[model samples]
Structures are given as C-alpha cells and as structure tokens.
Target: MTGGAVRPEGPRASERAARPDGALMIEARSISYAYKETVALRDVSFGLPKGETLAVVGPSGCGKTTLLSLIAGLMPSTAGQLRVDGAPVQPRRPGTALILQDYGLLPWKTVRENVALGLRIRGMKPDAADQALREVGIADLAGRWPHQLSGGQKQRVAIARSLALGPDLLLMDEPFSALDALTREEMQDLLLSIWRRHRTSLVLVTHSITEAVYLGQQIMVLSPRPGQVVGLFRNPTVGDRRAAAFHEMVNRVRDALEKGVNGGA
Candidate 1:
C-alpha cells in the first residue's frame, strides 16, 4: 500500500456499485472478429453485471485481448452486438477507460500532466485529476516524469489517469505484466481497493490464474486460437483473497485452461 489507505467511501456508493437487482452493464452475444482472414475470436458471448469484475484468462493468442478490445470499442467485431450501460459500444466512448501493459503514458508529460491528460482532452478541469494524484498516493511525485518513477509508480500513474475520467467500465489488458513480483502483488491489492471504492465494472485480461482468481468476481476462460468461452466460474473469494477458496479457484481455472488448451475446445 504505497498509496495512503484506500478510502472506503469514494464519491457515492451507488455510482461505485451498480444496483443489486443484477442489472446488466455489458452484454455481448455471438461476437466474432478477424484480422482480414486470420480469425481472432469466434462466437464469444458473455454478460457482465454492473459494478462487478469479469476476468478473462486463456492460452496465448486466445483472443483475450481481442475480446477486451471489442468491449472497449477499440475495434469493431465482425459479427454480434455489444452494449455497455444499455447503449451500443462506440469507439473511444467517454464512459469507458482502457489501460494497457505498456503504461501508455506520454514520456514528455509529468505525472500530474499524465493523470490530467484525459480530463484535459475531455475539456474538463484539472481539479479531479489533482484529487486522483492524491488518491494514488503520488501527490508529491506529480512533478516527476515516467522515466524517473518505478514500475509500480508508473502503473499507479496509469491507474490514476484512468480514474480521472470517472469511467463506468474500466478495461485492463495485462497492465501489471511488466512489474516485479512484489510490486505486482501490491498493485493487485491497490487495484482491488480502488475497485471496491468505486464499484465500477472492471474487465481484466491476464495470463495468471492467481491474478484472475484473486481479483475476479467472475472468471471467463476462453479456448486457444479462434477463442470461445470454454468455462466461466463464479469466484467465492471476492473480499478475502487469503482464503482457501481463492487458491482452490485458481487451481480450477488452471485446470480449465489446461483442458481448453490440450483438448482444443
């Protein structure tokens, strides 16, 4: 917890958690995609409830990132419909935020500048961005550049940048893949803390079973190449990552992934 203790009460509770009636925040049906002739995803379908997380785990080149990109509106699908917050997903929707493993920060910009970049692009003031720096516990380093920061700090800046937008859905593609083990674990806790506070729907694309089980409320396992959903499991250790149930679920996901990869499901 490099950042100060995560504030449990952030903004509004309702905004953080979607209604308890199980309202759907994202719906994807029979979605398929291809790069010209090479297929990336095929007939993939899943629904994500508001304020919950859906962690996608699959073999390499299994279309995990492709599926995320489809949901984020970074690219269009070849078939099927996707709706987020009850509306069709469009390119670069203001209500959605996407973070990648590369950190995606402009090297020229300072930490504060990077965090405030999104708000500035949206023609919003820097007040929220300033608050975001405080939230991520990098207020003193706001003047620092990306090269001057550690991997964890850079990731925090990236997270802060995304939070500055106040997104309804936060999408991450192996965002902590490059961090060291200890830093990665810390970042995971930091992410969960923020998610608990904001209640914003999150979709994480990761290769680590431990990560998927520890952070995901629901886990989606896709088959290798031309990926399709092979399994979906409801994780029981949402609030308690130290529980036996969490490790059990990790093994389960690993087993499912093995089966998916070996059986070519």
Candidate 2:
C-alpha cells in the first residue's frame, strides 16, 4: 500500500537528490478548465513540494473544487498540463486520494466497511483499513453506520478511508467546513497530527481564511469566476498555528486574497 519506490531513471528521480529534501509532488502549468461555454479556471500554475501542505482559497464558484478534481485525476484539463508524482495524472492514479466535503461514505455501510472500500478497490486486505481507523481514534466505533456517527466522526471515517490507501498525495475539499466550531478545531488538530506523522503531501481547498493559514504551508489565492493564480504565499510558521507569526502569515494571506479578488494579478 506504499507509494512504491522511485526508480533512478523515473520522471522525478533523475534530479531528486538535487531538488531539495522534498521534491515536487504536484505540478500544474498554465492549466485551464471549462464547462461548456463557462470557463472555470485559467492559466493556473503552482508546484507543491513533497510532504508539504498547500491550501487553495478563493471566492465561491471560483473553481477550487475543479482544481482538486483535476489533481485527483477525477477529470482531465481542457488545456495545459497537470502532473502528480512527476507523471501525467490519469483516472484512479494509485498515488493520489481525495476526501470530499460530503464524506462520500455509503449510507448503508458500517464505518469499518466504508474505510475498507478504497483498500479493497486497490486489491489490498482490510488490515490497513483497520489500522487507519485506529490511527483516527475510531477503532471502537468501526461497526457504527454513517447515520449513527456525528459529523466529526463521519469526517474521521472519510480521512481514515483516504489514509488506508497510503496515498502520497491527499486532496481535501473543505473537509471541515461543515463541523461545529469546537469540532472543526478538533478535526484541524487531528489533521495536523496525522500530517506530521504521515508526511503525505496535502492540498486543501477551503474558503475559511483562518483554516487556510493554520494548515497550509503554502497558501494559493485565486480570483473569482474564471479562477487564476493571483498570488501564492509561503507560510513561515508551518506548524505553529497559534503563534503570533502564524497570525502575521494569516494577515498576509488575507491581504493577498483581497488584492486578488479586487482584480490584482
């Protein structure tokens, strides 16, 4: 269930050593997507280094989820290039996992079954799935159905489902937006802890300013409607979410968002 080994001659392996400790996990260049006559994204470009977290923030209907879908290999770009683990992403790429806002669990499935779904799809046993549930602190509730779980518990199941696959890259679409404040904070802490332990590359799409600054090592700001990369802010306090430095970074991201939404390039 690992991301597998990287061959010396493989796409990113040639200069993997020279490229910094964590090489690029995802690279998008001049990417664009359209739904019929409406353009969703345009000229969006960014590179996420391995083991880092990237947060994408933008106004509503700005194609944030669309970008995540593209990276997750759910769909292809209408124009430009998208690569995951240095290879062109295609449908169901093993190195990527996506956690949607709705949890995406089958209502009739028990918690354990839901978590085991992805692993089963990859032809792996349910061992990793059980391990994932334990990691998320829900091993005791594995038999509970989705209807029997609270919002936070359901989200944990979603996270565990993704983690069970051991994906090198995890794509999350506002996974905490629906939780209550206290629950959301708890989930955020859980995510940070899991991220520190797993060191998996993460890209989260969120509209919350505070959440973006707290979780993202790099915050990418996008414009309205026809989304584009208006700015990309690198956070200095990667794990110090409550520090003064973290607040400063948040202000910087907020300013960038304002400028970008106000028509800055």
lDDT of 1 by residue, 1-265 (tens): 1111111212234544444456777888888999999999988878787878878899889999888899888888999888888888899898899999899999999999999999999899988988888888889999999999999999999999999999989999999999899999999999988997787889999998898887887788988999988778777676566788777888888888888888844
User: For every model shown, what is its TM-score relative to the native structure?
Assistant: 0.91, 0.90
**Candidate 2 to truth, TM:** 0.90
Candidate maximizing TM-score: 1
Regions of candidate 1 where Cα sits further than 4 Å from its true position = 1-19
lDDT string, candidate 2, 1-265, tens digits = 0011121111123323433465689888889999999999998888888877888899999999999999988889999988888899889888789899999999989999999998788788988988999999999999999999999999999999999999889999999999999999899989988987787889999999889887887788888989987778766565566689778878887887887788864
